[model samples]
Target: MRRSRAADPRGRAADRGSRTVTLTGLVAATALTASLTAACGGGTSTDTEGGNTDPKTLTYWATNQGASLEHDKKVLTPELKKFERQTGIKVKLEVIPWSDLLNRILAATTSGQGPDVLNIGNTWSASLQATGALLPFDDKTFAKIGGKDRFVPSALASTGTAGKDPAAVPLYSLAYGLYYNKARFDEAGIDEPPATWSELVAAGRKLTKGGKYGLAVEGANLAENSHHAFVFSQQHGGDFFDSEGKPTFTTAANVKAVKQYVDLLAGDKIAAPGNAEYAQNQSLKDFATGKAAMLLWQAADTTLKSHGMKPGDYGIAPVPVQSGAPGQGRNVNSMVAGINISVFKNSDNLDGALKFVKFMTSDTEQKHLNSTYGAIPPVKSAQDGGTFSTPAQKVLRETLATSAAPLPQVPDESKFETLVGTAMKELFADAAAGRQVTEKSVRDRLAKAQQQMQS
Candidate 1:
């Protein structure tokens, strides 16, 4: 169900430099604080009434999404209230910035003091599971969430173990795709989005005249750079890792894709030179400001519209495919993305924690989340909600229908992405400096990656 090949442990957006979380939250319940601290020790002691003293209270930690998540909290709070009223339990929720979330979780896990239920990057599931701090999803737990069948198989796949019990339920799912500026396309006389790698190159070149860039891609950030390169590599028939979770980025397809990825900015001259130094914000700003005609982006169309761009001013499409490959129509690999839900093993409220997990990932909650934040719903049924306030959502959804594989799901994924990004940076830099993009140069760069993999 998780689309094994696409289960990239290094592929999620946070690592890719996509969005940053600016946290804004406060709780007015003193008694609740006391109960929580008392129940989960190992932190600076503080005195607050009812200090998590009650065993019936459940604490939840959610990563920052858009303001819509606050709305979700509002809806969920009432639902929790009803549950608590019936069961004589209390629910405490906290929202934290996504940037340092993993570090926070790791620290909390080590100290034995953290939320009972928490949201995490799906790719981090394996690493976190290694800590033995997560509760396995058994048959009883699965039933609490209306069965796993309600969610998209691919989304759920990323959340749990392939053969054993799952560590987490798929909360939401996302994929990457090409986002283009309609105004730029129209002005360039381009009528349709590119459908093949060849077309993409041609369109990019045509749109590159003038100071405007044809594409805006992040080249420095490991995840962003590697994901873009992965799409091209997969389209050309490259597989970055093997069944044993080993590095395999030096394949012929990878060589070709890497060349093309670099050429977009250096050889083809369709992308901005500054792209190598930019992250997600810079790329989005480039497209929004009309400095670039296209970019590979994740999530729904809400962010674009939020920038004051009209829906008709832009378009969405799947990453173009190579001429021939095993899955030509779906040759391109969009990074499988989304956060994972995990519970600390040391939590005293394991039962309450599991209940909250089931509630958050229920079919109903997924639909509302998808609708609220334009997040791709892990539940196939929930994915039917209204696309972002734009037709672009439909196009993006259609593109994702091919379901490009998730990124690598190895525990050492973060390190691998950095290696890929380093190779790309060197490749792009070499091309820009007038070096021949021969197989030798690529081989040399990849050799470094191979060496690192071995170490």
Candidate 2:
């Protein structure tokens, strides 16, 4: 995630916007990347990674959850060492990159050679569940990992589709928050973070003076674009799919959502024109380096610190809503974002894998790992007024508990992220070129995207 996402620093090291990486990782993943296209349509194989019959040994695949592949290894080696000491079980770990994680998992699902346990993006729970590759956590399974009550209710919601066994368990809980430069706000005579959409635009205008921009947007980053699009659509009372799981990309409220988000650049002029092509952590860089006064990001504290912007340099607040304060249902400002850990159904070491999951989600490990990554631990009791008590974590925690909503638990959800996200990317490019991003233009783009799905 910069899984917490793309090449982001250690908090989830990026955002759900980063997709399947850190939450950024590398290695074996190279081979998996090569066969993703083929694996998608391949018939399921009875083959599995059943080589290691030794009861004490297990294999694990983890998304890069730190500043770099090496950083993740450095942080995890010690924990694995500790785990090895406690139980004679040894976990051979392979860190996979975000760009290749999904492909690899798909390949594994098709081939039945996936590791005993691996991390997945929470949003992908339903899609992966549809594959039947992941081990479902039923009531009995939950009992293996300290019971379902141990995790937060909100965090557990994204584990899979409703009325089914969860394909995974929440590992690191994340939610979007508006991160603002305090000095810039204070100098601009702004007192508090924006509460409503109107106030956000107004505050942005004040911070948009001089060479520095008011807000940083990851316009070309498909996942970031989709995450924001989803949140905005929710605030506008829209859904990407109907009850039958059909794409509803161009609904009236949806069109409004895309327009409002895109208008941050096209209509408002608060974000920089160059932001249209930012797929990498360039937006995060802008916020960290003082080039932008505000950023809407997930678990960005550690990443900002990596850029030398300390905790005191910025303030975190709930992402603004369309009208009143942030809340459930319509007024949702953040999507439930984070990583989920799951065991493979074909794992040779099922018992060992379950033990590993229990160990990883243990109260002690949750505090240790989430603290290092700057993510809020999904385990309810893991958060014990320590590292998570800070203002940033506080806001993210509150948002997840109250305002955040899960992405639609449909198999086409990933497609929705891609199509609408790409459409928004195109709209941002048009805006960068000074094109009028009107209602018709927005609807046209969405209609085309929806058509791509329906066809």
Candidate 3:
């Protein structure tokens, strides 16, 4: 019953190699915070009627990776210029917010106004691949980019579903980690971060004092709820879907998993009720500030830095499980989190787009880009040493290699995130309002999601 790990809609994804779970139940991103909705409509001002076909020019849609959109532009500008100088191909880069990227890409797919190249959450790999809008990296295409072996085997796994050519190439790799406020832990006399869920709760109760909370959760964000739901379900040895990919969301284990998570607020009373109002990135803010003592996030080093948290302010550890040490199955700690570089199949400048992907995946670019963003490079060589060998990186990298699992590789994986995550959101709302969050209540909500999916 127990299986392995996996992101945000703005984006989360990971590779599933030898440890791949054929089970269809585990489909949700604990990857970095992904915005489930796009706030500002969709589409850029230009690129209205298909992409720029100019052989020497290419357009790329980059996800928000830095402290702010402006920061990303500052980081990527010179890199794009460097690529231009090397290949004589000009890159038109648009930094899309995580909030609207998926919708914008879908709009681009339907209207054919997308860019030549773009980044996608690895969680969307199979779903997007099913649309047949992305270029497939077949053996021939893999050869074009220094062979398929050039990438970390696990990162490559999230590129798409099994037995098919990857719909994209892994660029920046990530995995979830438990980040704790060092001083808070020290003040509480907790010598180390939590190793088990029970220990986490005990630590949380001790940390909850003076109007501050022990933990934070993006309780209102559907994508965030869905991710934790999937993760907690994994710890409880439950599956959201059966082997044939049908909804199985109301299992006993599922109820137990959902209850435990909600009980953090309803039962244990560690997380604040205000967390139920958190949808954007407030949980992150809460942890960055002193409002909360701990946070579980996908590669949050850069974001923490942006929030004015000094490097030594916090420490990273594996997300806690029910019990035992983290290895796989029940011991698995983090879901795969990463971004993928893809070429639109309809692009007029496919060559340039492919070249751009190759360039980004190159060891040099991977090093600079991943290091700059505090993300791990999916390229095997780039992951070997250097910045990736740091203390924080070692935690994330080890998780990806040994414990990280992919979300379901189903075409409708995104829908699972939406429906189930939303269902959990409503439950949290009820909990925040002082309503009883019972096992039966959790089951009823999940059953409704199952019915909606069937409908």
Candidate 4:
């Protein structure tokens, strides 16, 4: 969800507090993103046994955030400098925005000019792995990085596998939830945020008023929009994919959920006007500014701070579900999200890069990442010690307790999400226009997308 950017005095003070805590947290977190002093178990250098001649140097590329290279260098340069002092190796670092990352990687693969090590979004693991552009890490490589046992199984599972080889190592993790404005709820006479789909709609109706939307969303965000749709489907005991990983989103439960998704803007009239046109960040912006009362988004605690909202002013809960579902399933499904670090197949500094990846995923480093970047740790132990250290953390931790599932980990995931979302958008527009959504339309649309996925 987007965070509201209102200039509340108390909210401003809360923002300062968040920054202070984050700065203090970075001392511990920066370790995950920074330097590596320990040796990796798989220590074969192309410079030696692999018939290569070059100085011992490693190049790293990452999407910028958490800390910029300038700030990262302050923390990591010292660590790399120390590694050089101890191991006689040098490291170079570069940052790229996410928008250009994929094209750049594809270009590098074609030109044979890719960095020795690359940080990738977890969602892209399967796609990149399919290209055979990354070196698959074997047991020996895991042992070098302190083994698979050191990381969270969920994070480890996100990286693709070709047989026994791991395509990448997770660097951080994310999950989505509902972020509500506490003051708005109070004003609307809502004692607590709704816990079921029916109650949520009721709450939205009560809260929306002149010039304010009860909820904010961006139907145009095809990839992200699917996250909400899937979550609602799960809450209603539905599946977007059959056991064979084929599309099955036309189920009755799913149709109902899709109607709910559209009803926020259409029937209820509680969503921002022109919401269908907003992009990913716009909803977040609307929510942060108090233009919307509720939002469904991922790991927004940091952004909440930027929008001048605080923990007390905001309440986060698991995504609400159908009135009565099995497991008292109040929460919808969630996906594990994060970035993964991997070595390029043709990297000359394999040993150095592998060592660096391990250092980043280690418990100590994971702790640093949690503290510094406000990102969840990919290592289970490190996450336990990290920033999600309060009752507020429980809100997220518990929400994920529901059987949250991820998008299909397939090479065509991006295309699949796009197709599914495009179909959903058309149906959603109908739902918004007060047309009764039915199983026929949902099923027909899904079947077409499924066929396209197979093709």
Candidate 5:
């Protein structure tokens, strides 16, 4: 879920670039926190006196989605002021860097000291919900914000565990796309963007002649690699987990997908040899600087411009599929969800927190915030209102509504990331070193990763 920093326009400057957490440590910490809360009489109470409906002030921890904390403050302060004018409740906004947000949230969960409301990566919804530290939006509570039917189905599905109350609601949305250098394609005489796996390889071969490789890949970034694996696997009719949330990384469909992905470097030779060391940022650089003819990313318009690539220089298209696959690989993509909003269960100002959450997801605010950050709004009405004016953004909006899905929703999501991402890193290394990356090798590594998860 944590793929590229650039993909998330939010200021993740504080994120250590890893979401890995030890399940044992988390359980121990939660148990200790619960014990302390009971001893101190600090847990949330169900009585009328316990729920503070009319608080004078509310604390909000916002993820940095702009150039800096200052930038986000500039964008959000006016909105908070509007909320105060309308509700007589002042919001104390604290912009937390991505690096520190998760740890801070965990500590807050244990200490019963946290902001009334906050923004979280959508992928963390299920894991956080499992903690029971978040305020669940049931039918009565959901009406205060908006009807559940108001949100995009795919985006809304990511808010929590399926068939249960979601711990959060979608605030912003994003999706994966294939970006290409139009000029390079024209020069290579490639009439259209590749629409299938075989076509992609053929196009890459033609685009490979010039010092530039045909495709830029983030082989070194495990998160990015894991995402690519998910996309490829989905195209092959496979999923990372079963319906019961058990990991299925060693499935035949997944093995075929991973082998095809590794083949880009090991077999097709479309990506550069050094790409094994490239992170998302590095891969973007390669494409922006004309070192590669194509790249796959999400919410890349802003970053592409920042890197000096012009609007006319690139074109956005749906990710290529395996044409020979069943149903022509329709509706398959890298699982995606953007940022989501959540309220802490232990907050004294529950009323103010819920109101703020609603206000943030309201059509006006969704448009304002997503427009400033260049991301797609999560609300169906906002998306339909022509909020995304750019060709790329529009494409992403369609992709989210039609094809995108949340990553495997399991409490061990962080563990899934580690196992799959680490395996991908090693696989890329082998390919870069010119080792024979057979299908058996790929399957064996996946089998080992699956075993570690079980152990």
Candidate 6:
């Protein structure tokens, strides 16, 4: 499932082509540190003891980005072996599932018992950086892992606040894409993927029949729901936060977006009635099983193939925009950073870990690993020269370049996820249960959620 969440293989061509936004400042360090400590339910320690003192050995925790843990090991062993041969450093790699990664990371940060290097979801980068538990990539440290400019600007921006040394660097990059089953489209007599929200609904109406939904959605997973909300809000020319980084979930644009999202089920009835309980995996399964005709996802190619859906069965396109909105038709997309690499501050093998980081992002490794995982490589060089061989990868690269924005980089990002996601979940529930979800009702719910954040 690491591959499912870590690198969906559904979106983004290359990180370099993505739009970049500069996030200027961070919440006060003291407050951020305290927030992380409280959230993780752990106290930080400065202990650097018990680390492998041998310059030849390093520990790494890799997210499950392959078919399985064993598959990841098979893919990574040779690469690590190559690194050892060249740098004389032996890496002990542990492939962790997405379900256990965050907890394990918290335990390691609190107890100083963890790998020297690890992969984390980029969305968690700022939250983890606030803990002061990550080894930051400063000027000196960055020099060891190739220069800062070697990374994709947009990908690097997700690692930390602008003007601050980031605690991680983008490893694999991703972007959102509209995935539609070609067979289903043909069956429905649809000639092309929907280019606008209205057209999408119209197509959905045609695609929905014989117990098959027009679209699949992840309503139960708050994180995924929040991601969709972010995209919809942006398409409506609204964002979750204001210019000052304060929550603005109840803005008119946001309410409209949320209403439109909920209307897909409540008003349009294009999605399955039971979809309110669906998570990302479940929705993806529904799509794979032909229960849905369209899905918006990123980096899902390998997983889709594993699910028995071949590349030719599905087509990838940019997510549609609101045609009548202020920025309608403007290229805009969800905030997506596939997976990022971070070094622990308490690692006994800092030098070795840095070496591994550099090795992982190197052109050769980037190409090999990303190719195996069916994801976009974060390095510019790896993406050029026909490195992305598939049509989906090519489409994603162009989408990232023209669209893609990162989630808000506020210190309270997790709070935003919980609040906005929960609100969306409630809306979905209301729609699923045949309740009315008017504009005022949506505004009221968002207002309540925003108040909870402030409180």
- Give me the candidate number with maximum TM-score: 2
Residue 349, model 3, lDDT: 70
lDDT of 3 by residue, 246-317 (tens): 888899988888888888887888999989877655777799998999987776666677798886999988
The superposed Cα distance between candidate 2 and the true structure at residue 221, in angstroms, equals 0.9
| Per-model lDDT | 0.61, 0.76, 0.74, 0.59, 0.72, 0.71
For candidate 2, the per-residue lDDT at 176 reads 81
Better of 1 and 6 by TM-score: 6
lDDT of 5 by residue, 53-81 (tens): 43777888877554456867888899999
**What lDDT tens digits, residue by residue, belong to model 6 across residues 194-235?**
978889999999999999999987665566666667778888
**Per-candidate TM-score against the hidden true structure:** 0.80, 0.90, 0.89, 0.79, 0.86, 0.87
**Off by more than 4 A, model 3:** 1-6, 13-53, 326-329
> What lDDT would candidate 5 get against the real structure?
0.72
Candidate achieving higher TM-score, 3 or 4 = 3
Question: Which candidate gets the maximum lDDT versus the true structure?
Answer: 2
Off-target runs (Cα >4 Å) in candidate 2 are 1-17, 20-52, 326-329
Name model 4 segments beyond 4 Å from true.
1-55, 64-90, 161-164, 249-254, 324-332, 425-448
- Candidate ranking under lDDT, highest first, comes to 2, 3, 5, 6, 1, 4
| Candidate 4 lDDT, 115-148, residue by residue in tens | 7787766655665666676778788888888888
Query: Which tens-of-lDDT digit does each residue in 1-455 have in candidate 1?
Result: 01111122222421123322111110111001212222242222233331233458777776554424464466456767766885676877776544445556655654556777777667656545544567667777778767867766666656644676777777656666677888888888999888776788889888887788888866654455666666777676676888887888788877777877777877787888778776434566677778888877665344555466665777777666676345463465576666667765556666566666666676676666656555666767666645533565565455455645656555545455556767887777676566777777887887787677566
lDDT string for model 2 (45-152, tens) is 333543335667777888766556777788788998888898898888888866567777866765656677898777777767776667889999999988999999
Model 1 / residue 130 / CA error / Å: 3.0
Query: What global local distance difference test value does model 2 have?
Result: 0.76
> What are the RMSDs of all candidates, in order?
7.3, 5.0, 6.8, 9.2, 4.1, 5.5
Q: Name the lDDT value of residue 279 in candidate 4.
A: 46
**RMSD in angstroms, candidate 1?**
7.3
The TM-score between candidate 1 and the true structure equals 0.80
